[model samples]
Target: MKSTYQTKDFWAGCVYVAIGLAAILIAQDYKMGTAARMGAGYFPRVLSGLLMLIGLASILRAFLQPGERVERIQLRPMLLIVGSTLIFAASVRYLGTVIAVPLMGLLAASASRMFRITVPALVGLALLTAFCTIVFQMGLGVPLPILGSLFGG
Candidate 1:
């Protein structure tokens, strides 16, 4: 019989519960107002409460139902994805949305074992970059440049 502590659902539930509780605790410092006029902490507190409820349900389900054991973490894909995210954060200001988004997308996509650079992949990257540029830079008027200072924009 598989131990309850070894189940994937149990660990996932624990993670969710920890994060929810942390958020709830952090939110307590801010004032919570009525639903109609929510204060700074209201949304975080409400969302954290819901997250805690979901986590509790999952924890209960883990005890009631047999589940697969937690698998070993895949290092390559995890490192690639995390590295790409860090690169994106570090490069966004200098490279701007136009370059950084596609660069990050390419790096992230390469994390997949079946990843390949094809016409379709390139098109997807282009579309992603365009969407980010339009929505974040143009539409939302975020300060991110279309082309950054490095490109003399």
Candidate 2:
């Protein structure tokens, strides 16, 4: 008998399983009321159960279907993107959106091959910063400060 494999689907299924299990575990402490009187945990538990089922189906399909294998992961872009996100999360409170947004954009830009401190890049950064401000700050009413206490804004 020959063995069939689909690395992408298998890995995606594994990730879904992990996320579902984690959500289920975290929601265990909360009370799960009946379907009619839904508790805090009810929705999460139901969603997680669905996710688990989808993951199971995906895993089964990986073995049954003929699909491509997972491509090699790129470390540089991954690290830069992840690191920039961490920086944004950690510094958002201290640096505020006005400063943190541009910094995050620059870090993300550095991950790409066309990274340059050119006029176009600066314009793009400005546009991104404005969009973030309008969407997250003005539209969503997120309480993040535009300027931190250091700048006194």
Candidate 3:
């Protein structure tokens, strides 16, 4: 006997396929270019095509697997990810990189299994923040506002 059809996963796959197709169309309009030189839309167009392929595979998985457990999308993890993003967005502009990075780390850490994060993890997160800041601000020469010059800028 066939297992229960996963309606949510099926619909999500359909939506992904539709979105991928739309992206391809839009990227085409933006003039994705030749083999030697890529236009603004080239990578997006290629990525979207791959996405469409993956969506089809997912749709097949949802139906063809015998006695497959219905995949339940957990709300908690979703909420955690979404909440962290929101917090980062809200704080980034006002707080700036110096303060924002640590705050972002703290808020993001709350999303994990442990409400209180270990010092090592916190340190790791801080390093990630510093790496991102340096790469964007110094290496790429993009201006990221640092709230206070804690590291002497």
Candidate 4:
């Protein structure tokens, strides 16, 4: 008796399909060489194809099985997570990864109803920032400053 449109799986599948299709369409303009010698669009096209397959499977499963209903959207958490990403992107150049990463993590974690500013959490954030800094800035030799331009680094 439940409508398929109200199922969580259905909605999730729809989102995946939309994103996959969009990626595939956008990648169409780029060259797609052989797998051994991949072109600019090769990875995107391949990944998008996989995503579409998964979405189709999900859609099929939604129709064949009873699934949980799509619940009301949680705007607070959604907004917090999205806002954190945007803030990180906007601030990284000026504030650098050392500060921006933890700031973004804290903002995103606050989206959880049970989030607390414990010492452990702070330590974890610090470790994460350090790891990202080493991996991205040092290991990979990314040009992003550790201290950033805002601090005259």
Candidate 5:
């Protein structure tokens, strides 16, 4: 008999199970401690177990309910998103948050079809830069420079 379930859910469930089992294995060496006095591994182990359960439920739900078929993944957006993250990580140390934050915003915006190099994108960049600066630098008092040594700061 043909299965009514989507293959995607089954595979996703398998992945979750694998990850949970791996976490359990890795945490085995660490001291679990009591429920009151949790050890370092306890949280990860518990979270992984939960993830596995959720994945299993998703798989089961797929069989019982109708769902939209899996769509093809878009590579351009994925690449741009990953590239933006890498750019931010690489530049933040040298260029500092003031420069890197806006740059990341621009790059991330470029990943979407809705955004373009226009007034709105520029305004978004400005807003994001201000928000990040206020939150991470002023409010949180992170040690990152407003302008790095590269900029003669």
Candidate 6:
């Protein structure tokens, strides 16, 4: 019925604080130019500060307010998300964006129970993919690895 936040969340918050603080300090070692372009360190420093604030908030909320007991722990959805991400990362180099993109899409879609991948869905996916390839590759001339030509290139 009642529970504090997960111990993992507390530790994760602490870790974020440490990382943000470390990043801010480390960026000072880099060469940042004057105010016009913003020094190399400026953006990172700002981001780290933001992260630090979030981490502090996370820590405070965990301590003060707490969270409800997870009455239902749905492992399948979590597994699907994590597994698909791993598959996407591992497959990207071998398959390239053309194939990998669809696989990633399918896997992400598969993550939800109600979303069954149908023939129409597959067709739509392929068509949209072709549109993307044309827009980004042919029209815009941005470089993305197509499925073929890897044997030669």
Question: Best candidate, TM-score-wise?
Answer: 5
On the 0 to 100 scale, the lDDT of residue 72 in model 1 is 90
Error of 1 at 41 (Å): 20
Error of 6 at 7 (Å): 8.3
Cα lDDT computed for each candidate against the true fold? 0.89, 0.87, 0.74, 0.93, 0.81, 0.75
- TM-score, per-candidate, Cα-based: 0.56, 0.61, 0.49, 0.56, 0.62, 0.54
Better of 3 and 6 by TM-score: 6
- 1-153 per-residue lDDT for model 6 (tens digits): 134555445656788899999998999887667668887787898899999988888777777766543356688888887888888678665676688678877877777878977899999879867876788878897665666345332
The order of the candidates by TM-score, greatest first, is 5, 2, 4, 1, 6, 3
lDDT-wise, the better of 4 and 6 is 4
Sorting all predicted structures by lDDT, with the top scorer first, yields 4, 1, 2, 5, 6, 3
TM-score for candidate 1, residues paired by index: 0.56
lDDT (Cα, tens digit) per residue for candidate 3, span 21-105: 9999888777678868988888998899999998887777667653345578787877767777787677666667767777766
Write one digit per residue (lDDT tens) for candidate 1, span 1-153.
458878888888888899999999999998998999999999999899999888888878889995888989899999889999999889888888889899889999999988999999999999999998888788999888788779987
Q: Which ten residues in a row have the lowest lDDT in candidate 5?
A: 1-10
Comparing 1 with 6 on TM-score, the higher-scoring candidate is 1
Candidate 6: clashing pairs of residues: none
Off by over 4 Å in 6: 5-16, 20-97, 148-153
Worst 10 residues of 1 by lDDT: 1-10
Native-to-model Cα distance after best TM-score fit, residue 66 in candidate 2, in Å: 3.7
Between candidates 5 and 6, the one scoring higher on lDDT is 5
- Local accuracy of candidate 5 as per-residue lDDT tens digits, 49-115: 8988988887786677635555678999998899999998887878988898888888887888887
lDDT of 4 by residue, 1-153 (tens): 468878988888989999999999999999999989999999999999999999988888899995999889999999999999999989998998989999999999999989999999999999999999889889999888899899987
Q: What lDDT does model 2 reach?
A: 0.87
After superposing candidate 1 on the true structure, give the runs of residues whose Cα lies further than 4 Å from its correct spot: 1-70
- The predicted structure with the larger lDDT, 1 or 2, is 1
